[model samples]
Target chain A: MMTTVKQAEKFAAKTLTEDGLIDFFSGIGLIAIGYFWLIDNSALSAIMPLAIVNFWKISRKRISEPRIGKVTLARGKKGNVRAGRTILIIVSLTLAVGVILWLKGGAGDVQGTWYYPLFAAGPSLFIATITFFSAIYLKCPRFFGYAGWIIAAAGITIWLGEGPARALMISGVPFLVVGLWTFAKFLSAHPKADQ
Target chain B: MALKPEALDKVIHEPARLLIMTHLYVVTDADFVYLKRATGMTAGNLSTHLTKLEGAGFVKITKSFQGKKPKTTCKLTAKGRKAFEEYRKNILEVLKT
Candidate 1:
């Protein structure tokens, strides 16, 4: 009986990890970073969240439905609100810190010093932190691995002076590839239900 | 603190139905296919269990069509959730003793 309960719990946790939605969103966010850097266009990058949402919805309709079927999570409404607040807090903190540092020494004074590295590292660290929290909340260990990669990539980009935008793009590649792989695997695992 | 077996909910006592209820407790609603995959049960078995749950007013099943395809979703009713909670409490109490 205990074993059965454990298995049920395991299954519940696995549901969070099974869909690959996180990977897909992460991939899109990273690619947006890359595009932002390559084109130096903030406008293009600004659309990333929307793009991720649309892509996820479309993919769920096309790819996920045929395979794993639809699952409307019970806590989805509350989860969305929490996720939004978290992102807002992270973005606000990043901006506030950047503004403070810039005011202290001006852009020129801060550009070649520790401030530059901190600025470059801030967003990635935020992503890593969020992923870590998600890993804990979802009971999915794989997210920790993703967080590690984001942290490592952030550190490397700081050392290389690649800027946060470029670093995000660079770090995002693995997530994008992994997301695609996971999507493909999911497609194969469950075929479309017969009409 | 001996467990009165009668305290346990007979409807939720079955392992398969217990698993199904547990899944519903966590999520707002889940489709038939999702439940089947999660519980590793055949369509017929799952359907049968769902019928029992629905009959007991423990779960609400909704049927609709998405495009040309049919969709069936299940959710735990308020009574069902309360009962599950009570069931868990009783089980825990029994285990503690």
Candidate 2:
């Protein structure tokens, strides 16, 4: 047997926990968005379903049906907070900052210099937090962690700096691409256990 | 005892796989990607070990499409469950000597 195979199997075995499932589902959401753009043609529309997928994936995995049913990731003592907390935190901060910026600037136009940057902050912080948490959750850094950090950086850049929409578009594309690629790789490598 | 036994033993004896099986033995399904990351293995590596386990009839590998991508799940089989239990006892019995 290939030693790498043994290593991969060992890794898979450890990830068989509830927190692991959530991470995997978050990955699913990221990958689904890639395809969603193809089907819906609107990245905005894709976000909703992507959110929905995150919700659905967790719920689906959490409800365990006995015998040929879904299994739960192990939870001992306090369970690791999945992306849910991270998502909530990012959304909250984005809104808080958006509100603060809006109040400071006074709303002449909602989409002006203020809100676009605010919007960028949400995803930027989200990707960053996820990158941090999941990397920590895995007990080390992964290639995905690096990619996610880059996405987070682009998002932060879009938030802090003033630029043409084209700049946002340019940076956003690579961030999204790298995020999707990591998710796709994760999905392709997932093992199927025949019951 | 069996050619596959050594492979199964490798999985079973490993602290991580044993821990994984301890969880999976109760659950019906688990995502392989999650498993691999948790176990700290590479993509090609995990698949190979899975193939070995599946070949031994110690575990079941089910491949399905979750949207366009393949979602591979793993579950312990009746045979696998039985074999591991026996294997565990055998190990314990030997240790007692």
Candidate 3:
């Protein structure tokens, strides 16, 4: 934690409006897909936006910085944990497409089987979990911070059938709100540290 | 290509401005107080650099009230972002030399 102060001070923090919104859009994009996953897969609503937001944020960082700091540049890579992420996305999309095909293929009920959701939900949820844990360790109010974890946990609960799907949706509302506040706090607390 | 040659060099030349641009580039935008803190400069000193930037039209400043408190926001102009990119390039080039 003491070392985190130097770490924190070494970098500049973005304002609630700027830094926060980037994460907010990203958070919303992920949640939107997760919600679509819960409701109907045909919506095709979440994937494009998620892809767009993620790519945009990535390009913004890489393009905006000319000779990026070694620290920040490295962190932006989102892990060359490339295989795990690619597999997660590909499998999740495949499940989504399969489920939609099933529903439209004359199976009216979209109720998912336990085994199937493990394939669809598990990987996505796991990624969120990684994000959640990292945010906690970083001592920042990143979108994947506690609020994200709480919503994500609820989503996991829903996937496991321990909680209602609505619980996941309801859990997310607070993340949308308080995540902004926490981001502001992060910025305010470190106002002079960048200098 | 993302940065104009002139703007990039301008921001690159000064160590403080280089620091300032790097900080701003990271967070997207910053305020006077945050800049002061990050740069370790006094308010007046921060203000002077800010004024120079504001005059050059690299950064845009907005003054408003956040309830009873006055809030000032400083955002990089497209011009300013170009300058930051330029600054980065110049530094890299210099280091290479």
Candidate 4:
């Protein structure tokens, strides 16, 4: 009985994020955001995750549900997933606002200070925190891996004197690679269901 | 007084159907393919069990079309949910004994 309960819970969690399409799109979005930030285009970087999230919803319906099938989880479960997403959006927007303010000279300058490196590392760390929570709440192990990778990449980039742009770009690679591979395997495993 | 052993829900007693019921109980509803994958049940076996479940009025299977492809989704009925909960209670009681 307990085993069955656990299996059902696992299924619910898997339904939250199974195909990896979100991660795939997330990776591309991160890379784009990194590029935009590198060019000092804060607006584009700010909007990228939101755009990717919208695209992921459409893509899941078009690409994933048709292949693997669909499951509408319980209301509480759905809410939990939504909450995780909302937290991510909040973090991204907060980072964007901070960056924009710093650019506008609203925050006092300290470009040469140790805090500058911390500033560059901030977004990635925030992303890592969000992903870590997602991993635990969504019960998706891949997000945990993503959280670790993002943190490591952020640290490396900062240590090497690179900015958050580099951190974001490097952080995106795993998601893209794994998402594509999972999508391919999913397509193969579940062909388009015949009428 | 000892509880009757047969008081346990026979419909959900079978392993496969129990698996299906447990899955449905956890969600609002699920499609045929998702259930198949989750349970690791063969098409024929799943179909047969679903038929039995439908006959028992424990599961409601809906057939529709998503674009050109046929879609079959299953939802546990109110009666089914009650039955499943009762079954769980019974099993827990038995285990306690």
Residue-level lDDT of model 2, residues A76-121, one tens digit each, is 2134574547565766777578757766776444455636665444
Q: Could you give the CAPRI-style class of model 3?
A: incorrect
Scored by CA lDDT, what does every candidate get? 0.77, 0.52, 0.52, 0.83
TM-score per candidate, chains pooled = 0.85, 0.40, 0.46, 0.78
Instruction: List, residue by residue over B1-97, the lDDT tens digit for candidate 3.
Output: 3434564465346666556655655554665656665677677777787777778777887787645645567777888777777666665665673
Report the lDDT tens digits of candidate 4 across residue range A88-144. Answer: 787777667667657666566635654666678778978887888878766789899
Clashing pairs in 3: A192-B37, A192-B38, A193-B37, A193-B38, A194-B38, A195-B38, A195-B39, A195-B40, B8-B86
By TM-score, how accurate is candidate 2? 0.40
Ten contiguous residues minimizing lDDT sum, candidate 3 chain A: A65-74
Best by lDDT: 4
> Could you tell me the lDDT of residue B6 within candidate 3?
60
- Give DockQ: model 3: 0.05
Candidate 1 residues lying further than 4 Å off, grouped into runs, are: A1-6, A19-21, A74-95, A103-110, B1-5, B95-97
Which residues of candidate 2, in runs, are more than 4 Å off?
A1-10, A13-72, A75-91, A109-122, A138-140, A143-152, A155-160, A163-195, B1-20, B23-97
Docking class of 4: medium
DockQ of 4: 0.51
Selected candidate, larger lDDT, 2 vs 4: 4
* Candidate 4 Cα errors over 4 Å, as ranges: A1-3, A15-18, A75-110, A113-118, B42-48, B51-57
